[model samples]
Target: MSAWLFDLGNSRLKAAPLGEDGLPGDVLAFAHDGMALAAGWDSVLPPRIDAAHVASVAAPALRVALLDALAARAGRISLASTQPAWAGLRIAYAEPAKLGVDRFLTLLAARRRGGASLLVGVGTALTIDLVDAGGRHHGGRIAPSPTMMREALHARAAQLPAVGGGYRVFAADTGDALASGCLGAALALVGQSREAAVDACGGPVALLLHGGGAEALLPHLADAVHAPALVLEGLACWARPDGARR
Candidate 1:
């Protein structure tokens, strides 16, 4: 592939090839860590990548390092940023730049389906955004994600383990309780947002679920679409010749 797409999130880095259909193909994920900066990245990277498009919600240092590495291989590199509006989608933020580009791009990709929709991204944070059929954004909410909640609890209370637990309807153990509570909180938010979107749009709204933590919520969330790389999908869109800002 001539064009490469990179999505750098707080916890991970994902890359894929930009297909002829303007969508990403076969995503590859890498864990984010200070050690092993290069970490066999060059081994997996495409040999003749000509241009690279990136959407980053990672630290500035990570972004610089990743972009610099890509720059060495690709002649052109475009970093996506939040905009007031793009690709027929208008952001609800009064100061649009304050909105995260991952959120922005996810909305861009979601609204392209041409209907009322709610976007629920489960990552370092759980971000929710609503958009109507016409691509008019109706704002969103942000909260600590299930994983973050677990981490916070573990940090504050020594006995709580951050990593071991499974969501259950009724937890008989503390670990299960923590997992259930955190995940249930996210589910409730999505449920409420779906109802609100239905009322606001005067019709049923499709819920698009994305990010690393999305799968755990999937079996519980009926009538929802799982998009593991929605941000990368939007990066592909933004990489288009016409989608680029002047």
Candidate 2:
């Protein structure tokens, strides 16, 4: 059966189809409303997809609308949750139900690729989760994205110009200094978390990075696996024959 996957992240909504065609289609990112992204799903499906899997961290009502739309087109649909499952991947969260589905899926993807991996999702917000060697999901950290950091400085503080993504050793002067401060700080938080997870896990860890900032931030990641489609891949696995974990 074909698989359609959706990851509802903090900033954008991402969807993918799993098949023999190689890579999943380009990820579509839109505001958390789900309106703009939902409209495009139907047009992209080839003959017809057999199944759909959605892992949403958005509000229940928003998820309901998106699920209704997908169910109307594809009959088999699975909604991911943070609940502890009987099998598949072991969840280590004290309260798995409160954990974000996207984060769980990301950990699953990292485990499938290789255990003890650091899953970093850099979208509207930056998230760094660790799957320990013993198969426990040790949760993760969240920080404002590079873009958000830049925008916040501008919006909240005076004389803080808005800046885009770029690489610099760390700014020395005001404009470049502020831009570098925002971007560098964001990356530093993510990188440090990844390192901490590795240390805490007591072994080498594979770093998987994904989301809207993947392309822009890939270069800055000197020690990451650079799996830009991680969320999509995890979504595909969630829709697979044995997709859930305990």
Candidate 3:
């Protein structure tokens, strides 16, 4: 039976085909503005699959909307959630459910790579989670992502444009400065988190970067592994009994 995976995030809905190997096929993304769907949301979606597995960090209403859309296409649907431990990986959260499912899934994928890993997801928020060589969650941090930082700045000051410019070492223009500052801040956070992970885990840490905004941070992160479909990749792990050991 064929299965498709859906990752409904705060700003994007990504879907991919789940192969027998438990790896996701080409991923397709759709922009979701909180409650509203952006243009062409339906045009990009794949036709009905045999079953669907959904991992959502969106609001309850958004999940409802997504489920409704999938109901017509999927014979069965399963939702992913945060658990204390799964497939050798243990969550550090005192209240596991409070932790985002996206983060939980990311850890699963990170663990699949084996050994210590630092997952950096840049979406509506910049999230960093550390997993030791033994698959023990060492906690994480969430800050405004680059895009959010720009939006926040623009919101506070009407003069600043939320969307404009590129990253530069020393920005000559306002837009470049905003871009440089936000991305630089993300890069610095990653560096600091890497150091902390080394100190906490007392060993080397693999840098795993993912999410829609990950590209902007890529050029700056030299030792980073880019897995844009990481959340869905983790969803594949959650779908299987053995967690698809590669």
Candidate 4:
């Protein structure tokens, strides 16, 4: 059956076809405002699909817009939500519903790799989740991403440019300094999280990086696996008929 997977993040919408092997096909991404779909979005999806599985962490209005658009093309639609335990991966959140589905799905994908992992999603926010070899979540941390930090700073102090600057160890210019500080903070958090994960898991954990901003940090991470389509990969698993049970 022909199916599609959608991962609606805070600032972007990523969709891919689900192959027969239950993995995502080539992905298509579009950035959207919090309130509305981007122009020409309707023209991009396939003419029809048997199923549409969505994991959305975007604004409610954008989610509704996406669903409404998909309704015309999808025969069936499944929305992914956080669960306390699914497919052997147990959540650390006391209230599973409070956990973002993106993070949950990321953990699900990480667990499937069959080892301890530290998953970092660098998007509008920086999210770090750790799962052991046994598919047990040890919890996670969230913070503003480097891009968000820059935007926030620019908003408060107009002199700081929100977009242009290269990261440096010790920048002489204000823009580079801003970039260094923000990116450094995120890198430091990831480093600390990795150290904590190693202690908790009693060994080194595989570092899996994803999300729009992951590329920025990939060069700095030596052993990180960059899986930009991880959430979609998890959505493919979630869409499987016998995949995960509550």
Candidate 5:
């Protein structure tokens, strides 16, 4: 059976449908309003859908609203929580439930990637999750995207212009300088999180990176494998009882 995976974040809603083989068949990213059949939301969808799951970092009311919207279009819907699933991997957040669905789903997907992993979800907001070999999911860090970093700086201060574009390791000019500075900041945050995970677990942590921002964010992180379908893989894992590898 096919399954739908939704990573609902602040800026946009990322949805993908996975085929029986546990790989993404179709992908769609739309503005939050588009997905909502309600008043003001941009909605995007495939011609048809089967079962669907949502990992939402939205508020309770908003979550219920979005669930209601998806339920109208899809057959079955499951809302994932930070409360432990698949045995170990207890979410170690102060308010575990408040953890972003994308972050939690990334960790769930990381289960198959293997233990002692550094899970990174790069989108409008970037998140890093650390799962030890024993399946203990000690939480990681969160930061704005490279663009958002510049945007925040511009918003807070005055002179800095809102910057956008990919990162460069060796910036030669002004554009590259801005991109590299923002990129370096994001990489530093991700690297520090991975280093901390390695120190705590006393083993090398495998890196699994995904999300809309992956194209721009992956270059800066060292030795990170890009798995764009990680959320879909995790959704397939949740849908099927018999183990299937993606």
Candidate 6:
């Protein structure tokens, strides 16, 4: 089947073909704002696809627009939702619906790695989730990502630029200081989460990072596995025939 996986996030739309081995092929990402939606997909997606499996954490309007676009090109479309328990990975949420599907799908991919993991997603928001070797979730934390922090600070104080500067332990300039402070906050949170996960899981936990901003934090973290296409990988799992039972 010529199936494709779509991960619609807060700022961008990521798509990839699902290979026979149940992994995502080369990923293609598009910004959902400013550009004409139809034009963006038209230039990138194939002429037609047999199936399109989507996991969206975008705004409702954007989600509806994506579905509309897919309707014209795909024979079948499946939307992934958070499940309390599926394929051995159990959620920690009392109300499963409240959990973002991106985080849920990230956990699905993390569990497949077969070990205790601390999954951190750095996008518009920084999300940290921990899953044990047994596929049991121990909950997570969410906060404004460094990019968002910069944007927020810029909004309040126009002099602080929203998008430049290198991360430093102690920056002499305002831009670098902003970068350092915001990124440091996220790094600290991840560090704390890893420590907590180690205590809860009774051993050292694997650290997995994903999302658009993950690359920026990679240098500071040792032995962290960067899986930029994790959500799409999870979507690939959901697209499988035995996905629900696996």
- Candidate 4 local accuracy as lDDT? 0.91
Off by over 4 Å in 5: 32-50, 58-66, 164-175, 241-246
The lDDT per prediction is 0.88, 0.71, 0.89, 0.91, 0.71, 0.90
Q: Quick one: best TM-score, which candidate?
A: 4
Candidate 4 residue lDDT tens string, 1-246: 789999998888998989987789999998887778789976977799889999998888889999999999999999999889888899999999999999999888887778999999999899999999998999999999999999999999998899877889999999889989999999999999999999999998999999999999999888999999999987776887773554
Clash counts for all predictions? 0, 2, 0, 0, 8, 0
Runs in model 4 with CA error above 4 Å? 243-246
lDDT score at residue 77, model 2, on the 0-100 scale: 82
Q: What's the TM for model 1?
A: 0.95
> Model 1, 25-71: lDDT tens per residue?
89999886743344787579866688999998787888888988887
Specify the poorest-scoring 10-residue window by lDDT in model 4.
Answer: 237-246
> Could you estimate the TM-score for every candidate?
0.95, 0.83, 0.92, 0.97, 0.78, 0.95
Q: Against the correct fold, how does model 2 do in TM-score?
A: 0.83
Q: Candidate 6, after superposition: displacement of residue 107 in Å? A: 0.4
Q: lDDT tens string, model 6, 144-244?
A: 99999999999999989998888899999998999999999999999888889999999989999999999999999999999999999888877778646
What TM-score should be assigned to candidate 5?
Answer: 0.78
Runs in model 6 deviating more than 4 A are 34-38, 243-246
* Model 1 spans > 4 angstroms off: 34-38, 243-246
Q: After superposition, how far is residue 19 of candidate 5 from its true place, in Å?
A: 2.6
Model 5 lDDT tens row, 56-130: 765566677778777777778887665545534567876776776566666767776677888887777778889
Candidate 4 matches the true fold with a TM-score of 0.97
